[model samples]
Target: MNHQERTHAVLSASGAHRWLLCTPSARLEEQFPDTTSDAAREGTLAHELAEMKLRHYFQTKEFGKRKYNAEVKKLKTEELWQDEMDGYTEIYKDYIKTLALSFPAEPYSAIEKRVDFSQYVPDGFGTADCILLSGNTLHVIDLKYGKGVPVSAEENPQMMLYALGAYQAYSFLYDIRSIHLVIIQPRLDSISEWECPLGELLEFAEYVKDRAKLAINGEGEFCPGEKQCRFCRAKAQCRARAEENVKLAFNPDKGKLPPLISNKEMGKYLAYGEDVAKWLSDLKEHALKECLAGREVPGWKAVEGRGSRDWTDMDAAFEVLKEKGIAEEILYEKKALTLAQVEKTIGKKDFAEMVGGMVVKNPGKPTLVKESDKREAITNKITAEKAFQEEQ
Candidate 1:
């Protein structure tokens, strides 16, 4: 997709979950405009870095042209264009080459290929980070720059649509047998994969075609869910989302308690606190917009958020720390090591062999969480001692 076409009317792969569930959201979103965000700018830099690394790997670009500058024109210096991004993009390039190595000849590889999924969704198109067309399989790799949310490969409509687009574009030349959808989240240090046979993928395409028809026409229902509303532009003012959150809170005017909850009831609404948190955040943002427009709400007024004092130059302040005879270690907090980063650095087998023994388990702090959380509950010391005595 070119610069102009990038913002056209299309059921974007990224927003597939939103339109598929809350079909009217696509139309409603047209009223709102896009805003440039820090996260979005960071993502742009990451994608540019990825493109440069991939292009240089294939020997298409000149040596000096491949270098990346953190400071873009009229943009603040990016802190993300360091060893982390470089290392991850190397891993991405290696993954593509490793898959292509198995082929008899040098397999065809494309970076940032503009894929058209219009066969399934109307005017649907997005750039695939990398596509490796090897023997009997098509590998579609997507590089996600965000670290806040971990994306999965299982039943991901966005990646699935990309697969359809890639298959349609290359099927004429290659006898493709399967489509491999992969999501490489570098910041999370995760590589998730999903494979679908040609037949099964086509079935999903048909489902998408029907959904796209309804979504484009605004004829579908406004069924709200966590997945659908997470990235919706109109989420702050969505009627359906508000209604869903209201259902969780009971009638306050009625008598105090609603009696005890059963096992089934507790399991269902255990994780709903996050939804309430989202509602509060969205409501405040909505009210702030009205306040800024000279339409103040009843009880709330616009107020500046808290800010911290900062040195004119942080490096100069750090130099002052050296003059005071403060140890560098005392001045700087060492970044903690994550399990994912460790495992990624060394292969799983070597990690288990070399450094796994040094690992230690610490008791996590007591937390009130949803029953759906995978972590097993850790009982309090009193309860544990009582149960042990009873058993004796």
Candidate 2:
């Protein structure tokens, strides 16, 4: 497919999680121009590299070795190319191969396939990185290059939507009874999968349909929350979000400050903390941008912040420092390579075989989390002892 010709739908699959919650956000974001950062560019480059590797492996007839080598060389010439990306993309390709082996026969695999689900969602479409079909099961695989947050496939709206689209497109040709969604984040060493019956997927599709209809028309109340507002373009200026955060500071029941917060209430308050902090940061940035653009922002003006000095020539400065009897070891603090870096240098398989037995993971510090969290709760010894003493 000509990706350049493809236009993003108002109710796009990727933004389903956000738009489904805050239905108005999809339309509201249209006013803001889409901006790309270095991180986004790096992700795009990684995806391209991954796709190339998969094509070479799966469709060697179409993508010849010579062509693959030349394409990879061209990709390496790009500024964002990193040596680590090569290893990570290989990991993705290997995982896809393993998925293929799980099938009884050679599964029909497609790379960078475009699937359409416009029936449920108006003009809804997205590209699945890799998809495999065998017997009664269809696997929709996605590669998440970012390591900022580990993504899970369990009831994940984005993965579910991709599966829905792929199923819709290929159901006629295959008896697809089960749909499997997979999210692979090689950088984080995360591979999560969620499998469901066709009936359950269709139920999810109905849910998407209802939300997409509301989102397309900018209907439903603005429900501002942390995850939904994180990437919303209107997050900085949205009155609903501002109001929600403001309401978090006060208790509607008591119209006044409480002497102390109970432990039970603290969890609820802490949940709002991250959202409030992010909202304030985004608001400040927006105000600074407006001021920089010659617009008036009440009680705020753009000014040069404190700047740090840097050596004009680092190598020359370092040499002069060495000549002045400053010890090289003192000037440059040496540190051991991280586990991940060492693993990468030695090759993952070899590193694991050699030092995997030596590696030990200690218990992490106890952290407060919601009851619905998947992690098993760790008992705090002090709290347990205190409770036992009180009972005695």
Candidate 3:
């Protein structure tokens, strides 16, 4: 084992202590040929530790109460402890079943190869989470317990880097034609799979080699932006800090006439907004190209974007309650509840019976509503619906 692998072993062992463990170096960051900042390091570490704790909590039911109580104390809030526990337990059971069928190996939490990508030298190097030689293929599964959009495994630089390493380590012994890169993200409800062709994989290895040479020779500037900056630890000391103001301008809250906005401040905001828009457009184009560069899966299209939430139909809800002899006055006065809270509030059996045959209408689709648009849309919808009902 090299220095990186040794460090990972130490940290993984220490991670059993829950909160006291040190962070493991990200394989991608190590292979990137750029120095990562402390802030970025801290953020990544915190995310990993939270994932570890969540995994531990779900794996063993005996410590459920203790873990829940610890979370309550740490967060200093009594909100959603039981609900979270219930959801975690359900998901954990499902995942355990998935592992049993997919892996069937003895220890569920075993680390196969750590930073073992030395074979594809002068190209790229990465630490693989686990490599299971099942049947004819090698399954390289990377666990990303994060809540962000699942990392696409197809043409992923990190996965390719690991494949390069695997080829060097085991190509002589095994006739490996394909590298299976699987991202298991339980939190985001996403599972992504990518396969690498040997030829293309080698091409990417060359690209990595060229990039590393540029980075080492200081041939290119480290151009940081919102996407990368979000996780960058060196932001405070980074020269890019001055550029943040420009990025924040295009943020969701830009045009809102804040209670206080001086003319000078407004000018600065507008200037920053313009810069951010251009930067984001360029970033998106680059990412899209990188994603589709490798082999394509048959009948598999790029994922579609999901809409966000808007207002619920309170008036419709009231009408439904009225039909059930629940007075609007009483209903309006009572606290509103989320779907899950309602389940717990009335007990599962009663709640299920109450909504058994009822069809729950969704709120209208989400739109980018301006303040002016919000009032007009709500008024128009309510008025139109009322008028049509009256005519009927």
Candidate 4:
């Protein structure tokens, strides 16, 4: 009925596969706020791009189009879906070229193998990104494009889950001696890789399964911190998080204080348990606005009023020059002086002091400045000059 609700519905319907692939639970929507914001749109776009690149790679291979067409037929028949697929393919192609140049034969972009993690499923289901085969070694690369910090490839729950899924799905086809989890965050200047024995990965998978079970069963504790709460969409609804925000907003003694000898000493000494930072910030903003409006503060003096400057009266200067027997053309021409030239004429120290705190003001109300004003001023001056010439 409302904008947010409608947005959530559209996102949910369109991003069901993405949600399932990444978080695999309704609770993920509660946990990660960044995952729900406009930033999530970028992630969706990245995923679509990655998929398109993969499809294009397949198309280039023999019978790739037939295989892709068959898969598309199996998936859905929506025009919107097809358009998205095409868009993703183009994005992926560009992304892959960049990756290739950067990594150089490091097998950038998509890995087209599926993984099963049925044994590691603690509560709900989970899936891996894709499994990579490099010579005899097996590597798993996960792409994380969101602003959220990339999950460390080493000892990461998400990476471990993906490893489990990969091993489950692909072990039958390969010798599968070892598993390496690599997290690539192109947005961040980071690439982390971790290796584990086949046995170790399986053990970690089991550990993750236990954790997932606890989380699903409502036994998991909230990890409350600034970093965790930054993009959490469910923050307003979360009791623990709401309390944290209230404490942060109201806690006077919590933040860093300046040296106690100044006004800061009074602030710390009178540490009312409530946060006064917001009030102080608001007061400063209001004070600034009043000062700009030329309103006088009780204890503050108007040290200087602002005004504008203009060129000297050119006609008066020209008349003085003419009386001094100088040519009108030589005297009335425009000229610009450098700082050094000005300093020679007026001593540097005096000039510096004179100009140090100069404040320029608007000439007048902007509305008074019109084309007609200039014309009228010039016309009146011309009329007076003609009458004076007649008298002469």
CA lDDT scores, all candidates in order: 0.76, 0.87, 0.50, 0.51
How close to the true structure is residue 322 of candidate 4, measured as C-alpha lDDT? 95
1-392 in candidate 4: lDDT tens per residue? 01122233211312323222233233645454433445654454555455544555634574376765665464345332333334334433445455445543554223533344546554233333445554434667666665555546776655666666666666676677787777666556356788888888777666655655544444556654433433335433455544654565565455675645575555443442222343344345545656778887676543455989875896887788799998877765688996646644665446668873553444543342223232233222457668899999
Indicate which candidate wins on TM-score: 2
| Candidate 4 runs further than 4 Å off | 1-38, 62-114, 123-127, 134-136, 147-151, 245-392
lDDT of residue 250 for candidate 4: 62
Candidates sorted by TM-score, best first: 2, 1, 3, 4
**Which candidate's lDDT is highest?**
2
Backbone clash count for every predicted candidate, in the order shown = 0, 0, 3, 7
Between 1 and 2, whose TM-score is larger? 2
- State every prediction's TM-score relative to the real structure: 0.75, 0.86, 0.45, 0.44
Alpha-carbon shift of residue 353 in model 2 (angstroms):
6.9
Instruction: Report the error of model 4 at residue 156, Å.
Output: 2.9
Clashes of 4: 7
Instruction: Write the number of the candidate with greater TM-score, choosing between 1 and 4.
Output: 1
Output the better candidate (1/3) by lDDT: 1
User: How big is the positional error of residue 63 in model 1, measured in Å on the Cα after superposition?
Assistant: 7.6
